[model samples]
Target: MSQVRVQPTADAIRAGARAIRRRNVEIVNAAGLGHIGGDLSAADILATLYLGVLNVDPDQPDDPERDRYIQSKGHASGVLYTTLAAAGFIPDSLLDTYMADGSPLNGHPDRNKVPGVETNTGPLGHGLPVAVGTAIAAKLDASPRRTYVLCGDGELQEGSNWEAIMAAGHRGLDNLVAIIDRNGLQQGARTEATNALDPLDAKFAAFGWAVRTVDGHDIDELLATFRAAPFERGRPSCVIAHTRKGRGVSFIEDRVEWHHKVPSAEQTAQAIEELSE
Candidate 1:
């Protein structure tokens, strides 16, 4: 039997994002490792997609007709795991075992082990290509299912993404939507300081994509943008969402060093306290 999926209100989804963030901090702190910065950066995006946009039935995870979502920014597994648990794709008990010995929850997501994950993706440039292929397959099957991928801005420097972008546009895979977490910071430094992706929208547009930029933290805007897919016919849509790394935490926000830093017990308490507010 398929689970009922009543879409949450935008405000409710926003609260869900906050809960996801708090859970993420707890699990990451307990596990002593996580890409927390990126996890925080993309929380709102993940929550908005799972709770209010995607047509997924957690109880029927392998529903062939369900929409496909690829966490292209896979290192941010903390956020994804929390979102999956919150969305009921996985049990909340599973979170306590994150990264434990023999735990199904690895540092990076594994499709074979995790429910709601469409494919295995951890290599920086791989997810978009897979999502493009998924979108193309849906088109060929005449399926209404759509494919959405979340890529980090830093990963866009990979040549393979452009190749996939070129292919998606050329094929006019209007069912495909690629959302870039434009947080500006990567693991080591600001994206511009490492390898700039400024003019990113123009770059995608040049490849025949219809592009729109939105504040990634804005739940209402995110819901509206994602549901209004295929912003133009005959073009894959790209939503470049501007976000702050380590969002919602005053000390860590936008600081590059926090990319994969494990928070101390005190910091974790503070982060949880702030997120609960």
Candidate 2:
């Protein structure tokens, strides 16, 4: 496999975004099922992080000094797997096996089977604690590694995340960054309707994290936010990325039905067409 050059140009990020969006549509279309809305919502953030910000090597996935990324909203495994493939952590051909009877790439992420995945995460609110542990380990070893965890806004309702958030701040883990994919919608309905987590920025601030809000789909803003480290001394960072579930495809955007709906052949074709352009 050939490696793409390591350069953080705007064009590269946009290309990665397009590739991930295209790959997500292909995987779901081929498997006949997936969390398409969540996958689409988090595509750009994953692309920017993996291609530009993350200090990972496809050739040496388990390198100790490498940065770590944990996907707490693991239902969007399609997005992560495709991003891994694009980053050369997995072969592009393996993507053909997604969601097959016995494929390693299941509907949710499994760290044991995947090379670059830092932890197995499917249950909401799990990755934050794991990420905190990883950061703590880095601090203990005096390692200069950074840890990032991307989670859904609805997942915030899980008490485990709050616990982890408190610990991250209490420990003064400035090497850690938690990104929330605040698409406003969850599995069934809007997060506001299911369990309101508004005033999310203030909540994080009160918890002791330096918080920032940005349009998640904007490549420039995403890159800038990731580059700007810990908003304050002796505090971890939190970026609340306001995103639209099913961002690229018009039919699926902001529609709760697309949360976990499998696109039919026609819908798939339309999605591919829209994303390609």
Candidate 3:
């Protein structure tokens, strides 16, 4: 069967992202914990994938032929959970159980517990390797299924990711795509302060991957980029998505401390207000 690309309208994509952001704030406020900075920064990317790009069935999430998505920057589980609910993978009510005792929703994603999750991932640099293997398997079977991994820019400093980059490039795994959430800030400081990832596009290019840098929050650009994955016929694809931490909330925007900070009631209300517009 020929692939029919998914292309949701830009307005629809923006609405989806708004809902994800609103719900992410709600979940964090309820649980009194979350990585809101990264969650907000990557919310649009997550929304784009779940609402349009991914070939996933909410009712049949485990289908072998489904395209795969691994959230490499797993600290932002709130956005992942909110996106999953928005995509109908889980009941929206399940979001209430997040960070609660015995709840399947942990601070990091657990595929064994989440129906739509492709693999358990939290540690930085792990998802790409797993994605590489999955993409290799798809190639071996001659399946057209694709695999995507979203990693934080700071996470790129981990050595394991380069290893996967090398392997994917060397193997010509064109079925895979890696997106970096380039929000600039990490947990304790700016990514540049801790470890610079400048020249990131060139580095990926050096590894033999086709690279593109895009406005991560732009729904239209995100949809276009995802659809154009495997930019080169025999090479993997990499998208460096420049984003801002705490994107929808004016006060917290680009603030490093918001990485795991729970929003206060007033702050939550303000954030929801901005997102509503």
lDDT tens digits, residue span 83-198, model 2: 99999899999999999998999988887898998899998989999999999999999998999999999999999999999999899999999999999999889999999998
Output the lDDT of residue 6, model 1.
75
What is the lDDT, from 0 to 100, of the residue 251 in candidate 1? 90
Q: Which candidate order results from sorting by lDDT in descending order?
A: 1, 2, 3
lDDT scores in order = 0.94, 0.92, 0.91
Candidate 3 lDDT score at position 72: 89
Which ten contiguous residues of candidate 1 have the minimum total lDDT?
A: 1-10
Residue-level lDDT tens digits of model 3 in 10-103: 8897999999999999999999988999999999999998887898878778778889999989888999999999988899999999999999
Best by lDDT: 1
Clashes of each: 0, 0, 0
State how far residue 119 of model 1 sits from its true place (Å): 0.8
TM-score of each: 0.98, 0.97, 0.97
